[model samples]
Target: MATAREEPQTTSRARGDGLYYGWVVAWTSFGVLTITYGVQFSFGVFLPSIARDLDVSRTQAAAAYSVYVLVYSIMSSVSGALTDRRGPRLVLAAGGVLFGIGYALTGAAQSTWQLIVALGLIAGLGMSAAFVPCNATVVRWFAHKRGRALSVSTSGGSFAAVVVPFLAGWLVERTSWRVLYLGCAVMLLVGLLVASRLLVGRPEDIGLTLEDELGRRGAAQPRPATADDGAGATGAGAEVSLTPRQAARTTSFWVLVSIFLCTWLVVFLPLVHLPPFAEDLGIGATVAASLVSAVGIGGLVGRTLTGGFSDRVGRTVSLAAVLGVQVVAFLVFAVSDSLWTLYPAAVGFGFGYGGTTTVFPALVADLFGRAHAGALTGLVFAGAGSAAAVGPFVAAWMYDLTGSYRAAFVLSAVVNGMGLVLVVVLRATTPAHPGGRAAEPSPLRGTGQLAPGRRR
Candidate 1:
């Protein structure tokens, strides 16, 4: 059903130039995530300012972020369904506009309610739109390289985490937080333009098929597509496909959801409150902000390394190890007061946190298959979204009541330990194929084998 204008001409150029267009998709996804999550993650930098400026309690200020996460989680499944039907370009375009407008409006808010409406509801919807489509698109584009490609694309968030907090903190010192929000709005608009131009729904929309190594080792060859063929027709040979309902029926899905929930509960605690926590310890705001940047630095390494490592070590093992590190990191943060101690703790937490972002998507695809990846991943992400919504608020309330972050940090460590236990259980319970990949053969029916010369 693609219009003539919608069909990509890049397919022909890629065939002639000997470069796969899928890499283009990967980098484009990277750019989108970098800009969106970069701005999104910078909320901690703005949190203190918002509290000081609006005369709100820490719990009230944190509520804006909580609401954002709540709305974002609710919208993710909707966006994922839309992406499955309408494609990423439209979804991303809408996201860009919504994110820009919502962010810009936050600059004008005079009260906490206005702030929540501008940032929590509107901007949250925008982020929801951008996340699943880009991730699901990348999963569909590569088979042999799915994990690496997803990692590379998601590493943008880690890269953003490293840079944005420091930059926002520095800017807040020199300028108003309002200007920062407006600047982010402009950047999102530019990202939308890029997404509209380059973000295709599937590789088949451009006349290229998925990489040959995507299917079973000895499956039959795919038939050549005729000019009249639709995108679905061309992609009929994808190795495995599944509906969201079908995937939801499996026990592994619930296990994955629980893991996501616990990890995210721990992840968002530091992300939303790390700066204030550091400031409470007598660290300067700029220096406190650097703690966030340190997390980003560690995350950058974690995301990239975990992606490629999971391919070799298997997803469950990599996940369990990462969760174990998170538990130790939280405990470190709970007991430490010195900047020297906090820095290493930040790096450790960030590294483990970054690994989850990379591993979860690849794990979902590995377990459920690529066909309905967007919807299923979105459904799974609802767990994280719920955790994101609740975690910060809980931490803020705990701090307000107890007059310290120690209890909150201790709670994070405990939950993360619980996550590690779940990962172990998941690993033991989930069935694996002969090659060690999660079994997904039911969805592979009718998807022909890789072409002879095209196998990896």
Candidate 2:
């Protein structure tokens, strides 16, 4: 405990040592999320096996996953709040234990009820810790590098999507699903437990300032952000300190929530429906599956490239660009049935989705400041993240009512357009004297919105 809390000031002690320790935190976060998400996503591969072995209906068996999503999504707010007060160490430790034991229990279960209790409740509780703490902690550690740091951390899920399911399919062919779950339990336990030890809550705890950690003196200062820098939320280096409650009072906070709600609402519709949509057009099952891989690969590329791009351009401009890409992708899905076109559309959707996720947190920190980043980020996620669960279901419903997926695809494009418009509106009309002229003293009292000087 002491060693973890008192992690060496390796990033700031000298430049000769190597890269900043925040990068270490970012990579560790990536590793932990990879294992956690890989295991979580493998649930689909296990679903049919579990249903057959347990003698349950597919819907009955799948209810466990639905419950798991609901539980994890709701628990994120609680975990995020915990991260703010006690730091990530204790939160991650608890999550590791819960996840490990829960998954192990899932392996041993003989009934659907046990599956629900173990995976849905216990493992779901544990899954909540994977995202909020890791990204929020990284935010606390870096100012100039926040976007790139979060991009690295956020890409873990995409990487897992690309690799884990195929790996699970291969492993399941060789062994029972129970055995796979047990193996995953072991992997997640080791990965997350070790990661908990590597993370620190903030650099200040180790006697470092943000600048010192970036580089000696001003040598490591971020190259000035481009003119689009403050377009969506905040100008460079301006800080806002607001608790979750405090943030909730501001229009910008709600605007952010709405923005993400719109983003997430359309985000999963394609991922869930694309396979069938392709198959409906008489594409081979093998080709249909490959489209998912295209999305995953595009996601990996998007986050890797766009995080640094957001750092250079601005989170808002980057967000608008990606959202525009999404609008295009959905329109493609709406208007076309060609194999050649669908492949690129899938990649474009994945790229937009991946970039949106990476930008979300960096924009949060930029607008709200890092002081209450975990709680703030968590609240927005809690409010908006669940939209992912709905988008697919709603799209399916729309498909059921109508004969074709065209309407659903068009609807998604429209919702995506709404989000894009919100992004533009937010960037354009923010009051130059935000919070009104009577606004609180700044150190300039600026945060949440940009001032004119920021443009210069």
Candidate 3:
């Protein structure tokens, strides 16, 4: 009995309430994250085995892992921009094809070089396309439960981190490494298919609004930008006005980069080195590998808790607490020679590490604005990725030279502590972006109102 206008409005309201396509988008994206990032994270589990079977140096095999991180990290800006322009379905589908091709080709590799190019370069590029775009898209669709939605989506990465590595590691034991690649291809393909069906750039495409969905659900509402938020929200959007050249000119940017870089060096150190480190401590190989599983478990809990809590507390305080825990975890790793100590270290480090993905995005959105968050966060992440590129090689070289991983662990702790200092410095230097709401240029102007306190 609804009139024509009322029917469309009613449908929009229902969809906005997150009763239909929003949840579908969340779960579809979740499948992709769980699969793509899962495969990416599981590299640590396969590192030792790949080295032995291929007769390559551990450092050499580790470089493949480094490549994925580098690609995924460096391409965030481009991918985010592309997602905005084209849409998640195309981005994700293309990523799937490329990722599958990378893995499929990897199955034919006879040398470490081949694996690096295929898994590292090609697969990494695919991940870049799929992962960040999906995240950005999901964030666009659900403002109220953004924390919960993002936490759920990102936890797919953690779940895959645990399940893929353990499952792939076991498969390698029974079949071959090549078969493992095949499995990755299958998962990636399935994810791509799901994305085609479920993914959209934003609720507007489906005639829905986030406020309609989550607002009706009575989810926690994000504070609207007010005069106070203007300084923080300036210069954030799909395309960064400041290229690398202009961005490099800012002291705040460098300080932020320094903080992110130092933290990442330590992040991958434990992620890539933990399995080998555990084995060195007299833990059995399977059990040592299983310990890697714990990292994923810890990440799931950490990201969920941190994302939800940051909504209540401020983003800055939540970030500081998470990073502080990371420092403590590193200290534990540095001194602990036993499995008992190492177990706790893994839990703490994994939690802190995983929490970064959730916290950093929100931080970026808060400081700049979601519009610029994609590109700005991409630039910020590249710094961290660059640091990650060097960490594994350095950790491996140090272990080889010293005949022990203790020094490496100690060094990681020291580096993390340095990052802590940078973060403090960043906090002290308040941003000057005209309150949190920049005056919109003609091309970018829209009807959406800035949350209160953002407009000067």
Candidate 4:
């Protein structure tokens, strides 16, 4: 393991309000996610221009993203494992360099093949370093406050979704798409490289204890206990963490995989194809991009609102709500021909999409425990989120075939409905542990505590 850089125990926590350094780590990670995701999602706004410039078909342009998503999702496993072994600072620094180089090459690509190689493969490899390492590292920093911290960190994508597409829309109108891409390259290179220096892997890594941990444990507390519950419970030594390998061996993990797979398979249909869909309806370029912004706006509300809301209602309830909203959004898109309907549909779509990203990772931590959170979270995200690659391509292919997005929209609703059903049925179908007790609702169930208003 990479040695953590030394700092005074009070180094990041010297704030007057006594804000923990974990928040700093969380927000810093937020900055990186915002920029990366902003540029990624804004690809939709740039798609028409890119397709026109490269003399490529829409399906070909969409395939670039499909390849990128596939490569990025698969690479996340490696990045997450690396984050656990080497620390996020090193992982993020390397990612920044690779990510920047990929964008620079993307801006300069002369052909479809080059675009795929640059953005699809190279940039995807770099992006794999972003979600897993950033969120996973934050998990190591706080225990009891994990869900809140994660909501803040992941909201960068939502915030970026809100702002970046509009910014890209305006800039694309004023400048060449290539120029806009080069600007992103410069920012990713400079921003993540500098920000990585501010990260500390864990509170204990620097000889510091969480405020709640003081006077609670001796010097020899296990790492998992520090993460499973902040300061842990009475006889904290009894708590255990599931390794990524161990997590894979359990049936609950596969159920999570299925839940996420269904949601992610169609989540990107609107984000990647919505702007073009709006344009097909005779909306102006900038206005079409604003459709993306609408999604972002709802996403901001969803993440900020639902992230905390899930803590009270339980993750399953929160997940069901998110999927349910998406089903409605897709149904509206399928049935409505009126352009105005899209605005609300887009907002609802953003709400569901944003909320799922927040709850699922927290659920993984809640179920699997947090000692190897990076690896386990990566596993879930990679296994299911990889399906996100298919949405854009399928939508594009559908558009090419039928000259309408109606069928794809209907398919998306069905898929999201499946995910909702999976989350609902999950609690009952989970197998009992070898010890003859249920471990599926898992970390919460293991503790013999139901969410408020529930009977055991």
| Tens-place lDDT digits, model 3, residues 105-171 | 7777779889889988888888887657777776666544666677777777777766766676566
What's the CA RMSD for each of the models?
5.6, 5.1, 5.6, 4.6
Clashes of each: 1, 1, 27, 0
Between candidates 2 and 4, name the one with more favorable TM-score: 4
**Candidate 1 minimal-lDDT segment of 10 residues:** 447-456
Per-residue lDDT of 35-106 in model 4, one digit per residue for the tens?
A: 989989989999999999999989998899999998888888888888888888998988889889999999
Best model per lDDT:
4
Residue pairs with colliding backbones in model 4 are none
Evaluate model 4: give its TM-score: 0.89
Q: What stretches of model 1 exceed 4 Å from their correct place?
A: 1-16, 212-238, 431-456
Worst 10 residues of 4 by lDDT: 447-456
Ranking by TM-score: 4, 1, 3, 2
Per-prediction TM-score to the true structure, in the order listed: 0.88, 0.82, 0.84, 0.89
Candidate 4 overall lDDT versus native: 0.80
Arrange candidates, best lDDT first.
4, 1, 2, 3
Query: What is the Cα-based TM-score of model 2?
Result: 0.82
